[model samples]
Target: MTQQIQQAIAKLEETMRSIGVLDFSGEVQLLEWSKSTSRDGPKIKFMMQDDDSVLPFEVATVKKGKMAGQIYHVFAIRVDDLPIKTNESEIIALEPAAKQPNRLAQAMHTDGYFRNSKLWTGMEIAEAYSQLDHKSYVEKLPCCGTKFAKHIACNGDVVGHHVKTSANSGIRIKPPHWYLVPLCHNHHMTWAHGSHAGSATHEDRHDLLLPHAVALTANQMKVKAKKIMGISSLSEITIELLDAFEEEIFGEAGNKYEDFK
Candidate 1:
């Protein structure tokens, strides 16, 4: 290794020691810096040893500082290959940048929604939520939300039920979907995967509600119209009754069916 690489390794070793990490034997190599599309700023790869495991990491956004005429660099490292300790005590000092706004920090904040608290693996939670029923109530839903819906509908065999906390806390609510309105499996999946997934595709306000326009079919629309007319069946409506009902109920509300059609 060159002098710069040697210096980096020595710094990492010292960092490990300062953070109370033990058994710190590893190899460090200086890699070409590259920007991350999935995260903030530039990154470099670092390899380390961890008790029968070879840990690889992407050190993001290295910041250089000069102290007493000596130059020092701090690296924002992500444990890419495995789950490392993320507790405040274990991580806060090593990654103070985590306290700032960034994608990694946002992901860490929302991780509880995607990952299982007990197993601490994405696969485990994916499997569990995949079997959930899509049309069920939110309170009764298991990890019930758009995220669960995507896991069950597109990628797997399960359906997600919507759920909101009663007091807005804990998993006590049994059927989450009951509280939420029904959404098609596709739209539900999209919303669960990302925040931008369900937002309007175009810049216009009219375009924002486009998904609602195309959501129902002609048959579904007719059924909805029939319900609003308080008619038991579609055949019960006369032209005169339709006109009067349209003026009374639908004229002011606008033609929602027209948008769907």
Candidate 2:
């Protein structure tokens, strides 16, 4: 390892040393997939786990129970400050620019938490909130609103129900505002999940909400959104920058959607 990399490992080791210890928890540490790996490149792994929880353990494949794969170099979190220890002999504290993909220097919502399912990664839900219509999200829908409709006056009791979810309560990720609205749990669970009748569907919500979620995340108002989306030193986020990330991740679909637009 280069002197620079050794120094980074030393810093992270020091940080890990200082944090309080807890019961066994998972972590994402750096690895060298091959000797040719660049100094900036560290093979990230979700690390192994054995319990009711996984720091999103397993790996390959996708969906409900578990898939199998490793994770990589993301930063530490202020909350849930678990004891920091590593099994890996080599972990690098790359510069912020070279840290890892997504500038994931710090942990995002799903960085090291065990998820209930893998049918789809938490990644989709993490970004799903951004693809919604912010103005229509609140102004138009008092009770319920889909991509096509704006806020409709509540015919019944309404509360902020998150747009993204399935029947599985265990399956959830942080949602951005405009991603949530005044709707009963029935709408959040039953209606959107296709378990009931509504003009929009869970699938529709997923698809419709995605592009707008991409755009809408740029407008994350909630503190939770700010943390999960990694907004710091700013209140509002740039739609264009996030859009570019969407374009990079989603290709053309990241730009916009038809029914949603």
The lDDT of each candidate is 0.33, 0.36
Q: What does candidate 1 score on TM?
A: 0.20
Which candidate comes out best when scored by TM-score?
2
**In model 2, what lDDT does residue 156 have?**
46
- Over 156-243, each residue of candidate 2 has an lDDT whose tens digit, in order, gives 4444555554442234555544345445444444454444345465566667544443322322322223334454322233444444
**lDDT tens per residue, model 1, 58-161:** 11112333211212245543322334456632321122122223332233224421122222122223332211221332222222223223233433333432
What local lDDT score does residue 23 receive in model 2, on the 0 to 100 scale?
17
Q: What clash count does candidate 1 reach? A: 24
